[model samples]
Target: MEIFNNITIVSSEILQEFEKLSSSVVSDAMDILNLEHGGCLPHTIRPLHNYTKTLVGPITTVYAPEGTSLPVHLAMATHVQNRVLVIATDNYKSCAFLGDIQAHLAALNGCKGIVLDGFVRDKDGSQGLDLPIYCTGTYPKRPGKADLGGINIPITIGNIEIQSGDILIADTDGIVIIPQAYASTILETAKKKDASDAERLKRVKEFNYNFASNIHDFTSILTKDVAEYIKKHM
Candidate 1:
């Protein structure tokens, strides 16, 4: 039942700071560093509710088999406080990997949120809980608690290798994983980007400035007589 090995838990200070950032801003920062993948989950996984608020925390990863819920129970029992629980169900898409009861337990344990690469059910029940749950979709069928999969180990979701201690940012835009190794650097860049974006928005609102028009090359390309040139050459 103890699967919390080789997993690093980020400090509360770092997690608190990251909680302020949106996934879009964090993703923009990741793009700047040429980290193309940047731990972004697939669009298929979405918020269970219309929760517009962002969920940020270190990840407590769970790897479970399809049609089973034992791993989740183990994960909940061993999960650290203020961390996001990430579940990978071997790309399974049939049964609901989690439900309201599990959500309640996670919330009780101070978990920030839940992200599954599988599915979840109990939409109405989950809505009442304080935790935000994200998954590929929902299914009426429930999982049996028989199989015990890995916990706090490296698991792949949306082609991203999510490990324990990695920061997960989820909002309306979707989920993004910030690798523990680059979390500090990424957070610093993301904070700066957020500030810059805010300033840009203010300037645009105040002056209605078309910043894109300042790119002369782009403007020239747009206005280029490419059709005429192609006809003449042909």
Candidate 2:
């Protein structure tokens, strides 16, 4: 369909700012603006490795129906550089639609990260690929080679709608999709939310430190008073 031939990806300085914030902070910011789904993907989608770093980039989408992967291969051939490739696979969980070889190719082609609404394999072997892969789970079966999918088209993964030009910010916590049209407004709120969280964390740490050493609280005093009042009965 040549859908990606003229696609326009909006790159902005606000995206650079978003790179500094966590996904939770970004989701909170989206909530302030009443953005759809609060920019959250499914909680089941997680990085292949536990220590994977944050991924921040523009998006290029693929709609690969269950058991198909030709669209992902086609998009990677030309359109994926410096972008996070998001593939929606009709929520298929029986087998993996991606694997180590594709991940290696994605790294070699300068792709930033990969997100699949389905599953992937070779998580242990793909360790050195250096490209972050987020998916629902891992399986041993491979995907079919049928060319039954589309690139750079709108797709819904776990009820979160995504398009080619969206900004995808993913971290250890989860993924958050920010529409390019509101990047500036969302950035304004995200920075404020991040700062507020930092202040709140600092106060909480100090309170915890104090409470640990001075735990003779009202409950303890009340217990002692009741004990003394009942001493005569004993």
Candidate 3:
């Protein structure tokens, strides 16, 4: 199914604003809003040690075989400005799905980062690179076959079905996949949550306690409001 009519560009403004919000805050924001965007698996696969920037952009999904690299190359060749390349492999055990070379290319193309739900290589090689990369694991051994995958098709990562143009947000906490059509809404909810969090923090600071029980807080925290908000908005 078509998830979005057109690619809605996530302006650097929103991205920058998002970056200002801590990963814990963002996770809490998603939780407060009941947005299903985080909780990626195999947390051991982390953003390369030298990686500093949080990556955010629409998806350019790829699917490839274990021993092939063409799909990776194709995804890079098609990389549009601000896009995040996501790859779902038919074989998660075949080989590394990404490496220094592909990541460097993606960075050169104005892409933000990569979310390879399978595998990728190059920890030392990934250092000093300007891109943020996340994967299931790193493979010291090179990919076995090079002719096995496709790009720009629907694929599932972390067992979540991702379509082309889905919004991918990666930060220290993990990756969150939002359908492109809902990117704006997610941001709106995030914004709202940020406001709420600010108030929550204010109240806690004022109360000097671990919990809030004041009537003002009971109405303001709205932990139960998420369900109602989604029903009203989504």
Candidate 4:
């Protein structure tokens, strides 16, 4: 079941480290590095379930055509333990590419979750499984086995180039793809940002401020007045 022969596996320690960080924190770190477009996947993509827990894992990319399930099935058959399956459809919105059955198989194969840049069916079943699934939306129409796609290859979802081994951090905010090359550095920076954010939040709570001036740049006139009031009180 080794589909990607050249897959680069990230260590468990790194994955665990990323698990503690939120997508927003990682995105902020990426922005600080001037890699503005690195952390977000697409605005259309969203989590299927209401769970707010974050998903962090290396990705196994799958490029599938519209109304096809062969490539997805093949991806499920591969070594996917603790890995996130990223399915990039060719911007097809007609039929569902993945559903509960496939999600069950993915879970059995040790997949952490799935990010579909398309649609899926069996919403109830998928929700029952309690697996972390992020996608554009859901469709009632099922997919066909056309076998017209590739696995473990570079795919584009929302103009973001996703490759096998790239780390995916997804939560309620959205999905963030941290390229393998920049993962270590980004994680380090994100940790620092998370710490600073925690401290700032504590101060905000203590001072009962609507927003932290140091953390946020307020531009709106009303917000500016509020900031001034808070400053005067402090």
Candidate 5:
């Protein structure tokens, strides 16, 4: 699905709230709601470095170039503040598709962070940019003579499928791709899960789970309380 034209502006309060959530917890909450996993590569197998603030938005991907980088960059360069950049290589080539120079340019042009399926050159140079960069690896070779392959099109990185305008959320832990249609519901459910986890943590601290019971026979009571809480709040 295309990004909901009715983009919900993420507020400072919401962003701050997200900061308190572990990416794993958020993913687990998504699973609890039975949301699609979206797509992800093995974090251990990838050497991606995140440099931008954690935020979510529709994605826009670029394929390997067949010409100069400007054509694709200009085509995909957007003013969206929190959009995710997902660029895939044409052939899993060693040639770099993204680098610090392009990342800096994208940041200045108001694009969000980048997730390159291919290599990004100049890792050390990227330390100075405020933009987040996630890539397969770093290479000394800069993107060779732009437009060598192709912007704003669907592509896959590391075999993880991606489409333009799909919601993406990345943090220190890793990335989470949320289908566009599920954005609102996912966010709302996540709020509920966050509150529930907070309360459960409190209970665990106060009562200590080890002292509670062997099989934890209080499920019915807890379920009733949760139902009432949801009814009251939502």
Candidate 6:
């Protein structure tokens, strides 16, 4: 099946550029673009392992039932190089749908990371593989494996529905998704703003700048009326 739907494939070169960006920068870009919720998945869907590096990639998704992770295996069989494997487990809490085995396979498949709406197990072993696994949490038991699930289809993570090929960026702060249709625009906007954001951080570190000065006018991200209202209030 064609995994992409009228989406321009992001090259590894571009992915490298994105890797240098934090989820916060991308989230800020999404906020400026006014993508609802800024494409954030949810606060609950988080990293399973502590990672110093940011996870960046287009996602290949698996919609798994509460107990079965069969679709993940099938999806992993395909090309996942430099990709993030996202599994929607329907918010099942009874058990972990991912563990060391899946993490190992994903690493072998050249996947850059994993994101699940459900729990995972084998934390020690999975951590040993050095693959970034983002999930709701960890559960020791998963009961249903024979049940069927879909692969490479739209799946809901938190309240947001994520298309299979959406760009995913995660870090210590949180996770954010860039929809395929808006991918290029958001990426460009984020890349451009990233330079200024770095400069802003530098000023903060060097001079204890609180952005109390309105020189950059960070309120530009708001609607004209809202920005005007804030300006008047401030």
Runs in model 2 deviating more than 4 A are 208-234
Cα lDDT for residue 106, model 5?
Answer: 82
CA displacement after TM-score superposition, residue 188 of candidate 4 (Å): 0.8
What is the per-residue lDDT of model 3 for residues 1-234, given as tens digits with 9 covering 90 to 100? 112224445566766666655555555555656656432434545676655666667777777655666777766876545777777765467577667877777888888777776678777777776778877777766665456656667787665677777766677787777666555666777777778778877864566334644444344445557646645665
Q: Write the per-residue lDDT of candidate 2 for residues 1-234, one digit (tens) a residue.
A: 335664666656766788899999989899889988438999999888865568998899999885888888888888788888999899887778878888888889999899988888888778977798899989999888775878988889877899788899999889999988888888889999888778766655555444544334222333344546555344
Top candidate when judged by TM-score against the true structure:
4
Q: List pairs with backbone clashes in candidate 6.
A: 67-144, 68-144
Cα displacement (Å) at residue 5, model 5: 14
CA lDDT, every model vs. true structure: 0.80, 0.82, 0.66, 0.82, 0.59, 0.77
lDDT of 6 at 198: 71
Give a tens-digit lDDT track for model 5, residues 1-234. 112233334444544555556555667667877864464544732435544457555676666644234434653455245666666564455566666667777878777677765666777777867677776676666555543443555566555666666666677777766655555566677778878877876765566454546333334236556656655665
lDDT of 4 by residue, 119-142 (tens): 988888877564698888889888
- The C-alpha local distance difference test score for the whole of candidate 6 amounts to 0.77
Model 1 agreement with the true structure over 126-217: per-residue lDDT tens digits: 88677889888889898888757778887888778887888898989988999888988888999998998777666545653454544432
Better of 1 and 3 by lDDT: 1
How well is each residue in 1-234 modelled by candidate 6, as lDDT tens digits? 224332226667667777888888888898889886337877898888778888888888788875787777767767466678888888888888877887898898888888888888889888757589888988888546674777677788777788767888899899998786787778798998898767766654565346547733555444456778887787
Please identify model 4 stretches exceeding 4 Å from their true place.
1-4, 208-234
Per-candidate RMSD, Å:
5.4, 7.7, 6.5, 5.1, 7.1, 4.6
Between prediction 3 and prediction 5, the one with superior lDDT is 3
In angstroms, how far off is 142's CA in candidate 3? Answer: 1.2
Which parts of model 1 have CA positions greater than 4 angstroms off? Answer: 208-234
How well does candidate 6 match the true structure, expressed as C-alpha RMSD? 4.6
Query: How many clashing pairs in candidate 4?
Result: 0
